[model samples]
Target: MTYTHESKKPTAARREAQKAFREADAKVAMSEYERNQKAFHANRERLRSERLAREAAATAKAAQSESADHVRKKRIVS
Candidate 1:
């Protein structure tokens, strides 16, 4: 019959090294998440600003056309 040997328990140094590796991995993952969140917010703000600028331009164009029409009508009447 063949006998099987048990595996040795992990040493203190090996355990500490594993813990450090885990901490480093977690730190990297957290920083990556924060970076992605910041980029998302920046893009969202840019889109909002663009939409507001377009609305303001459209309003100005409408006002200018209305004023021009009013001037033409007044000249004809006079």
Candidate 2:
């Protein structure tokens, strides 16, 4: 009995399958990256808005106290 030696051959179907897999992987990666970026920006915006609100509240309170003090001082002097 004689056995034939194996030969290296490239197949079209295998190449097509490999190409499809690469494309699918790229799309999945891009989608995941976009999702992460969206979450990050959302969190950043939320933090910034919260900080601005706190600052505004503080400013309003300080202004009110200063106005009250001014009235008291004027009344005492007059």
Candidate 3:
């Protein structure tokens, strides 16, 4: 008995299955990328807000100290 050689071309069903698998894989990858991007932006925004709060506190402290100094100088000169 002689066996037939394998065909070089894939069957239509196999091609359809491969295409579906590739599309699913790409969809999963895109969702993962979006998740990572959202996390990154959230972290960046948190850091920015924290920095601004610290700067505001520092500015308020400096202004308070400067005003206190002015009051002390007036009492001393009188």
Candidate 4:
């Protein structure tokens, strides 16, 4: 007679418990990922808005200076 060593599979209840723990851990990880992503997107949006406002202000200033120069040239011509 030959004796063989075999590995035993986990019982159904143990498998179920492992599955539940894995699912709970995955949910926690996903929530943390979502929170970080939201914060990143919010910061990016805020920076983009600030950049747009600065550009608008610069454009407005340039246009005002150009208009003033045009008026001065007209007065000189007259």
C-alpha TM-score for every candidate: 0.66, 0.76, 0.77, 0.79
User: For residues 1-78, what per-residue lDDT tens digits would candidate 4 score against the true structure?
Assistant: 999999899999999999999999999999999999999999999999999999999999999999999999999999
Candidate 1: which stretches are off by over 4 Å? Answer: 1-11, 72-78
lDDT of 1 by residue, 1-78 (tens): 999999999999999999999999999999999999999999999999999999999999999999999999999999
Stronger candidate by lDDT (2 vs 4)? 4
RMSD after CA superposition, every candidate: 3.9, 5.4, 4.7, 3.7
Query: Which candidate comes out best when scored by TM-score?
Result: 4
**Pairs of residues at least 3 apart in sequence or in different chains that clash in candidate 3:** none
Tens digit per residue, CA lDDT, model 2, 1-78: 999999867599988998999999999999999999999999999999999999999999999999999999999999
Q: Please give the CA lDDT of all the candidate structures.
A: 0.99, 0.97, 0.99, 0.99
* Model 3 stretches astray by more than 4 angstroms: 1-7
Clashing pairs in 1: none
Count: clashes, candidate 1: 0
Instruction: Single out the weakest 10-residue window by summed lDDT for candidate 3.
Output: 2-11
